[model samples]
Target: MARFELKLPKMGESVAEATITNWLKQVGDKIEMDEAVLEIATDKVDSEVPSEVSGILIEQLFNKDDLVQVGQTIAIIETEGGDVVVAKQEATPIAVADVAKTVETAKESVSAPANFSDSDKFFSPLVKNIAKEEGVSVAELESISGSGKDGRITKEDLLNYIKNRGNQPAVAPIAIGTAPVVATQNVAPVAQKAAPVSVNGGDEIVEMDRMRKLISGYMVASVQTSAHVQSFIEVDVTNIVKWRNKVKDAFEKREGEKLTFTPIMMEAVAKALKDFPGMNISVDGDYIIKKKNINLGMAAALPNGNLIVPVIKNADQLNLVGMAKAVNDLGNRAKAGKLKPDDTQGGTYTVTNVGTFGSVFGTPIINQPQVGILALGAIRKVPAVIETPEGDFIGIRQKMFLSHSYDHRVVDGALGGSFVKRVADYLEAFDVNRDF
Candidate 1:
C-alpha cells in the first residue's frame, strides 16, 4: 500500500485559494479513482475535487469552511498500487530584484525552494521575488503580517511592509537594499470594535453570500472607476427572426444545438467589433489596450440567482454554427454550475440578454477593465413603414431595443453610438436565404 496526497488543484491564473464546503468522504471511506471526494467554492464557482487514484480515504487535512491553498495537500489516500503521481502545473512568475547585493543573499534566492514560505504561511512567487529584491530576510518576511486569502502574504502586504519597515529592527543589514532599522518604536493599540448585529422579532437579516458579496464589490468598483454613459438603438431584427424560424429545426438537426438569438446577435457584435477596434479594448490606468482578438462575454444566470459571464474566445472567428455551439455549451454549463474559472476570464467585451427576463432594454454595468457592455432587449412584433421603389406601406416587423453602455472616459459619443449602430445594421441585413 502507498499513501498519495490529494492536493487542492490550481483553479485559475488569478485564483489561489478556495473554501472547502463539504467533504463527501471521511477517513476510512471507500473511494474510487476519478470519483468526487470533496467539494469547494471559490469566488468564481463551486467545484468538486475528485480522487486521483483508486484508494480508501485515510485523512483529510482541511475541514469544512477551511480555506485551502492551491497545491496544498487537502487529503491523503491509501492505495494498493505503485506510485503514479498526478501531474500538476504550478504557477512560477520569475522576476529580478533590483538589489545591489553582497550577491550572496540574492544568489541564494535563485536556488530557493519553490515553497518559499517565510513561516508556516504560503507565499506566491511574485511575493517571494519582491522580498528577494527588497533584501527581506526570512525572519523579516515572517514578521510582517499577511492580508491575503487565508492570511497568505500578498504583494500589497509586502509593499506596505517595505514602506513602514524602518520602524522594525531585524537581522544584520545586507547593505545592498536594506532599510535603516530602528530598535525602539511606539505601537498603536486598538481601543474599541464595532458592535455586533442584534436581531429583533420580525427582523430578517441575512448575510450576503460569498458570490453575492464579490459581485457587489465588483459592480460598485466599476461604477466608481468608469465614466459611464449609454447609447440606445432600436434594431429591426425582422429578417433574423424570420431566418431563424425557417431554419432552426434544420439547423438543430444539422448542428445538434438550439438556435438562439444570442449567437445570431453575437455574430453581428463580433463583426461590428472588427469594424470598430476601439470598442474591443481595455483600460489600464491612463492607457488603452487595444485587443487583437475579439473575445465576447455572454452573460448567463446561475441557479443560485447570481450571474456569471463565460467568454467565447476569438468569437469573431466562429461561424454561425460554431457560435450556437459555444453559446449553448456555455449557457448549459453555467446553469448546471459546471463552468470552469478560465471560462469566466479574458473577456474583452460583454453582452447581456436582458430580453431573457422580458426587459425592453437596460444599461448594464461595464465589466471592469473592459470598456463596454451591450444589452439585448426583448423582441416584439411592431408595425413599421416599408419603403420600396414601387411604393411605401405599413408592415408588421420584429424589433428589439439595444442599450450600449460605455466608458465615456475613452469612448466618445460618435464612436460608441456608431459601433452599436453597426451591430444593428448587420442584424437588419441578415441573410434570410443563407444556409445554416
Candidate 2:
C-alpha cells in the first residue's frame, strides 16, 4: 500500500489560500477516486475538494476553519500500490502569532470579557479566539444569530455581532473585578440603539441565509470603500435585436447553445474594454494594476435569490459564438451551484443584467478592487427619428439604457462615461448580416 497526498488544488491565478469549512470524510473512511473529501471556501466562492485516487482516508492534516495554502497536502490516503510514497512535511497548523494577528486585526474597540468554555455551543477556533479578545461571552455569542452553514457561527457573523454589541445594554451586571473595568474601558462608546420594528401578529420574521448575509456584508463594504459614481446612456439596439432574432434559431441549432442577448452585450463590453484598457484595472491601496486580459465578470442571479459572478477569461479573444457558449456554460453552472471557486476569481470588470427583472436602468454598486461594473437595462420598443439621405421619418426602434458604475477615486467621469458610450457604440453598430 502507498500513501497518496491529497493536496488542495490550485483554485485560480489570484487565489492563494482557502479556509476548510467542513470535512466530509474522516480518518479510516473508505474513499473513492473523484469523491468529495472536504469543502473549502475562498473569499470568492465555496467548493468541494475531491480525492484523486481511491483509498482509505488515513490522516487529516488540517482542521475545519483552518486556513490552508494551495499545493499543501490536506490529507493522506492509503491506496494499493507497489511502494509507499514518502509523505511530504506535515501541514503546519496556524501559529500562535497568526492567531494573535487575526485577533488584533479584528479587535477594534472591545476586549474579551467572558470565558468561552462555559457554554456547550460549538464555535470555530478562529471565531472563538476573536470572541475571547473582543469580550464576547458564551451567552452573548449564542444570542447572536449565525449565517454560516448549519447555522454555525462564522468569523463574519461574530465580528458583526461585536460591532453592534455595544449599542445594547449589558447582558449582565459587572461584578467587582479589574477584568470588567478594563473591558469597559476598552469597549466602544455606546451609540443610540436602532428603533425596534413593530410587527403585527401575522408578520413572520426570517433569518437571512448564509449567502444573503455574505452579500449584505459585501454590498456594505463596497459602498464604504469606493467613491461610487454612475453614468447612463440610452442606445438604440434595433440592429442587434433584429440580428439576434434573425440568427438565434440557426445559431442555437449549429452551436447547441441558446443565443441570448447577454453574450452580445458581453462581446460589446469586451470590445469596449479593449478600446479602453484603463477601465479594465484594479485598485491596490494607492496603486493601480492594469489588467492585460479582458476577463469579464458576468453577474448572475441564482435561484436562491443570491448573486454570483462567474468570469470569462480572455473574453476579448472569443468570437460571438464562443462568447455565447462561455456565457451559457457559466450561467448554467452558476444557477446549478456547480461553479468552481476559480470561476468567480480574477474578474477585472463586471456586467449585471438588471433588465432580467424588468428594471429600465439601475445604478449598480462597483464590484471592488475592480473599478467598474455595467448594468444592462431592459429593451423596449420606442418611437425614434430615422434619418436617411432620402428623407427623415418616425419609426419604432428597440432601445435600452446602459448604466455604468465606477469608482470615482481611480476612474474620472470622462473615462467612466466614455467606456459605457463605447459599449453602446459597439452594440448599435452590430453587424446584421454576420454569420454565427
Task: Output the lDDT of residue 363, model 1.
Answer: 86
lDDT scores for all predictions? 0.82, 0.82
Query: Stretches of candidate 1 above 4 Å error?
Result: 82-200
Off by over 4 Å in 2: 1-5, 25-30, 55-66, 71-206
Each candidate's clash count: 0, 3
Per-residue lDDT tens digits of candidate 2, residues 1-436?
8889888887655565678989999999999989999989766677889887898999999998877766788999999996666444443332256445655666566654555445555566467656766667775676666655334577667767676776855555346563333323223344588999999999999999557877886787688788999999999999999988998899888899999999999999999999999999998656899999999999986767689999999999999999999999999988876788779878999999999999999999888779999999999999999999999999999999999999999999999999999999999988898988
- RMSD of every candidate to native, in Å, equals 7.0, 8.9
What are the clashing pairs of model 2?
111-135, 112-135, 113-135
